[model samples]
Target: MGTSLQHHGAETSPPPVCRFAPSTTGPAHLGTLAAALLCWLDARSRGARLLLRLEDLDPDRCRPEHARSLLDDFTWLGLDWDEILAQRTLAAQHEAALDHLEARGALYPCDATREALRAIGRRAPDGGFAYDNRSRERPLPPGGWRACHEPIRVALPAGTFRPFDEGGLDLAQEPALAFGDPVVRRRDGAIAYQLAVVVDDAASGVTRIVRGRDIAPSTATQAALQTLLGLPAPVYRHHLLLLEARGGKLAKTHLAPRGAALGLSAPRLCGQLAACVGLLPAPEDCTPTDLLRTFDWQRVTTIDRVVRWQDGQLDATPADP
Candidate 1:
C-alpha cells in the first residue's frame, strides 16, 4: 500500500483526482445523476482526471445490465470519465486488506448471527445494530466473521466541525461518535465498503472525492481506517442531497426510470439539470458548454433540493409548469 496522502492542503497537486462511483444495484436515480454531473464539472474545471467506478459489491442487488445502463445514461449526458473500474474486480485486494488489518490486530472474530445479536437487543433505533461488545471477549467461533472498532483512534474537533458538504453540516459532537466498530467483512465472506474504498482509492491514487452528503458521517471512521491501513485520505466534497417528495432520497433502488426514458437530448437534459441546480441564468434550455461558461462553486445552493423527479423532467419548484 502507498503512504497516507497529505490531503490537507492545496499544494498536494495541480488538482486532486476526483471520482464519481455509482452503485449498479438498479438504474441511476436523479440524485446519483446530479452527483455525477457535479463531479464531472469539478474535475473538468480543474484539468484533473475523473474516474467512473462501478460500486457493484452486492451480487444479489447489482446487475450487469444496470451497470450497462449506468454507462449509457452518463454517455447520453455527455459526461466523460477517464478510467472505468469495478469494485468487484478487485475482490482479491479487498480481501487482502481485511487480512492485513487482522494481522495487525485490528479485527476481532464475530460469530454472532442476526438472531443471536438481536436476542441481546444489539439492534439500534436506526435499524442498524448498535453492536454491543459482548462478543469481543469470546473465542473465535468456527466460520466466524471478523470486525474492528476498538480504540476508536479517531480524533476530530471537540464541538462543531464541518464534516463535509458546502453547508458546513456539523456532527453532533466528536465525529467518531457517529460510527461503531465496522464490519470489515461479512459472514458470507464479502469485503465491506469502507475497507474497499480506502484501499482502492490509495491504489488508484485518487486524491479527491465528490459524492452525496448522505454518507458524509462515514468520513471520520473511514479517515481512521486510512490512518490504520497507512493509506492516504482523499479530499472530500459532499454535496447537498436531492430528495424525493416523501419517504427518502431518490436512489438507484427507487426503481426510477432511466435517463433515456426522459426523451430529452443530451444537451437538453444537461441544461435542465443545470437550471435546477441554480447553474443557469434561467430555466430555459441550454447545453453543458453554456453551463460551463458560468460554472462557479460559489453559485451552488447550500441546502437540500427537493426535486420532484419524474419520467419527463425534474420540478425544482412547488408551482407546476
Candidate 2:
C-alpha cells in the first residue's frame, strides 16, 4: 500500500494516483460524463495518473456491450485514462483479500436472502432491521442460511470498524450502522462489491476516489475494509448527482434514451455537464476544453443538490435525485 500525504505550500509531495470505477450494467449517462470529467480534471491538475476500472464483478448484470459503450462514451466526452482495469480478470486478487479477512476472522459466512431481510425490517418498529449479535453467533436456521458476520476474534486497530453516521449527508454514514458483517462472499460464490473494490483499489495503487454523492455511504464500508486489510485509504470526494424529470437520480438503466428526444449530442451533453457544476462562461458558448481549463477542486461546491435538465431548462431538485 502507498501513502497519501499533504505538503506545505510551495513544497511538493508525490502526486496521488486516482481512479474512476464505473459499473458496466447499462449505458453511460450525464452523471457518468460529469464524474469522469471531474476525475480527469483533478488528476491532471495534480499531475497524477488516472486509471479507469470497470466494476463488472456481477456477472449476470454486466455485458461486454455496456463496457464498450462506457469506453466510447468517455472518449466522446474527451476524457482519457492512463490504464483500464477489468474486475472480472482480477478475481483471484480479490478472492485472496477475502480469504485474508476470513483467516483473520474479520469476515463470516452470510446466508440471508433479500426477502428475509425485508421481513426483518418490517418487524422493527423503526422500519429498520438490526442483527442480533447473539443470534448471529449461533448456527444457521433450518432452510435459512448465513447472512452476515463480525470480526470477533481478530486483533484490529483501535477505533476501527466503528458505526458510521450520515448526519443528513445523503451518504451511508457507516458500514456497521446499516449492515453487520455484510456478505463479503455471496451464497452464489461471487465476491461482494465491498470486498472486490477494496482489493482492486489496493492492488491498483489508487489513492483518490471521486464519484457521485449517491455512493458516498459505501465509502465508510470501504474505509473499514481498508483498515482491516491494512491497505491505505484513499481520499474521497463525492460529487452531486444528475437528476431526471421525475426528481430521480439518472441511473444508467433509467437515463433518457439517446437520440432526438433527449437531444444528446456529445457536444451538447458536455456543455450541459459544465453548466451543472457552475462552470459556464456562457452556457451556449462553453466547450468541454474550456470547462476543463477552469476546473479545480476548490471550485466544486459542497452542495448536494440534484442537477436537472429538461426541455431547455436546468435546475436543482430539493429532494434526493
Candidate 3:
C-alpha cells in the first residue's frame, strides 16, 4: 500500500481572487459599504486580485442608476478592483449552468407560489419559510425544467454538508432543510442569486469569500452546488454584520440611509466601518489603503455591531454579549 505524505517542496498556491458582489437594487448603504470594505481589505492585504461584481440579475429591483451609484461609491471609498462584471450580462453562462444541472437531474420546476409555500411551510433556521420540496413529487415536463415557465429550483442532496471557514464560523447544515432547495431561476426569467453567485465565483476563480455573517447560512447550499457542478470550493470568512439598534439588520429593504447622504467623507466613513468590525479603536478618519499593511483577521470581531443613525450621523457599538 502507498503511504500518504505531505510534499515539502510543492509549488505555492496562487494569490487569492476575491470579489464583492452587491445587488444593484438600491443605493449603497452603511451595511453595503462595510461589507465592501472588509472584502477589499481581505483581498488587498494579501495582495490578491479583487473583483467588483454588480449583481444586477434581478430585473424587478435592480436599476441602472443604482449600479452606476455603487461603482462611484466604491471608487470614492478608494476600493480598487482588478475587474468589473455585471451579472446580468452573463446570462449565457448562467443558462449553461442550468442546462448542466438539468441534465444531471439536479433541477426541477417549482410551480409552488410563495403564497402557497408560506401556507404549509415551517419557519426555517434562516427565518424564511421552508419549502416542502413538493415539486420533486411531480415528474418533469416533456422537455424538463426549460419547457416549464415555473421557477426552477436545485434539488440539493440529502445530507449535512459543511464548508470550513478560516475564521471558525460554523457552516454545517443540511441545505435541503436550511434553505429548502433554493431557486435557480425565477418565473420572470431572472437568474437567482444562489445559482448565479456559484457560477460566477467558479468562472472567475474566486478563492476567498469575505462577506457579512448574515450570509453564513447560505454557505452550505452554495458549497453543495459547487460540488454538483464539479467546481472548487473557496475558503470563506463571514464577518460581522452592522445592524440597527432596534434589533434589525441594516438593509436596503428597510430604506437604510446611504453613507453619502450622511455627509461623511470617504476617510471618515471608512474609519466608522472599520471600527464596527474592530479594525479601529473608534470612528476616526482613515482610508482603506491606510489599513492594508496592518489588516489581520484576528482583530475582526465575530459579534454583530449595533448601530444608530442619529442627527444624520452614524454611531456603532458591539451587540450585547
Candidate 4:
C-alpha cells in the first residue's frame, strides 16, 4: 500500500499556477489592489506563472465597461501576468463540470425558493449565516431554483491562512455541518460562485489560491466540490481584509473608491498596497517592481485592518480585535 502511494507521488499536480481573480461587479479599489499585489508577488517570488482571471460569471452585476476598467487598472499598476481570461467565456467547461457532478450524484437540481429554504436553516457562529438542508423530494417552485447540499461534507486541514505570504495553511472543516446544502446554480440560469470558482481554478491549473480572508468560509464548499470532481486541492493563502471601522469589510458592494479616485500614480498605489499587507517597511509610494525587492511572506499578518474615509482622506488603522 505504501509502495503504491509512492508511485502516485510523482502525479501530484503540475508546477504552481497562481491566479489573481478579480470580480467585475465593481471597479478595483485599494483593498483589491493590495490583495492582487500580494498574489502577484507570491507567484513571481516562486518563479511560478500567474494568470489573471476576471470572475465575471454573475450576469446581473458584471458589466462590459467594468472589465475594461479593470484591465486598464492592472496595466497602470505595472502588474504583469502570463495570460488573461474571463469566467463567462468558459461556460462550456463549467457546464461540463456540472454534468460530471450530476452524473456522479454529487449534485442535484434544487427547486426550492430562497424564502422556503430560509424558513428552515439556522445561522452560523461567525456572524455569518448558513442553510441547513433537508432537501428531499420538493417540487420545483415557480421562479424558485436553489442548489442544496445533501448532508454532504468535505474535510480540510487545520491551521491559519495568510495566502501567498507564509506557506499555505492546512485547516480542517466539516462541510455538511457548516455549509449544509448551498446553491450551486441560480434560478436565473446563471452559475454560482462556488461551483464556477472550483471549476475555473482546476481548469486554469491554479495550484495555489491567494485571496482575502472574508471569503475564507468558502474554502469548505469549494473543497467539497473539488473532492466531488476528483480535482487536486490547491494550497491557499487567505489574507486579511481591508475593513471600515463602522461598516466593516471594504467590499466591492460598497462601491469603494477606485484607482482613479485614489489620486495616486500606479507605482505609488502599488507601494501603498504592498505596505498594507506588511510586504514593505512602510506604506509609502512604490511600484510593484520596487516592492518585489522587499517581498517576504513571513512578514504577512492575518488580522483585519480598518480602512475608513474621514477628514477627506483614506486611512488604515489597526482594529483592537
TM-score to true structure, per model: 0.80, 0.78, 0.92, 0.82
Candidate 1 lDDT by residue in tens digits, 112-228: 556765676654433555445444444333442333322211122223333344446542323333434566666556566777788888877898887877777676667777767
Q: Model 3: per-residue lDDT, tens digit, 1-321?
A: 999998788799789899999999987877898889889988988889999989998878999999988888889888889999998777888988988998998888887877987897688767888887878765567987678788888888889988989888789999887768899989988888889999999888998888888788889999989988888999998888888778778877543434545777788778877887898877788999998878898888888888876675567777876
**CA error at residue 177 for candidate 1, angstroms:** 4.4
| Clashing pairs in model 3, backbone N/Cα/C closer than 3 A | none
Q: Compared with the true structure, what per-residue lDDT tens digits does model 2 show for residues 122-204?
A: 33222345432223344333332233342222122233343232223433344554554455666556677877888898898
Looking at model 4, residue 60 earns an lDDT score of 88
Q: Which stretches of candidate 2 lie over 4 Å from their true place?
A: 1-12, 122-174, 256-261, 285-287, 304-309, 312-321
Off by over 4 Å in 3: 1-10, 253-260, 311-313
In terms of TM-score, the best-performing candidate is: 3
**Each candidate: RMSD:** 6.8, 6.7, 4.4, 6.4
- Judged by whole-model lDDT over C-alpha atoms, candidate 4 comes out at 0.69
- Candidates in order have lDDT scores of 0.67, 0.66, 0.84, 0.69
Error of 3 at 277 (Å): 1.9
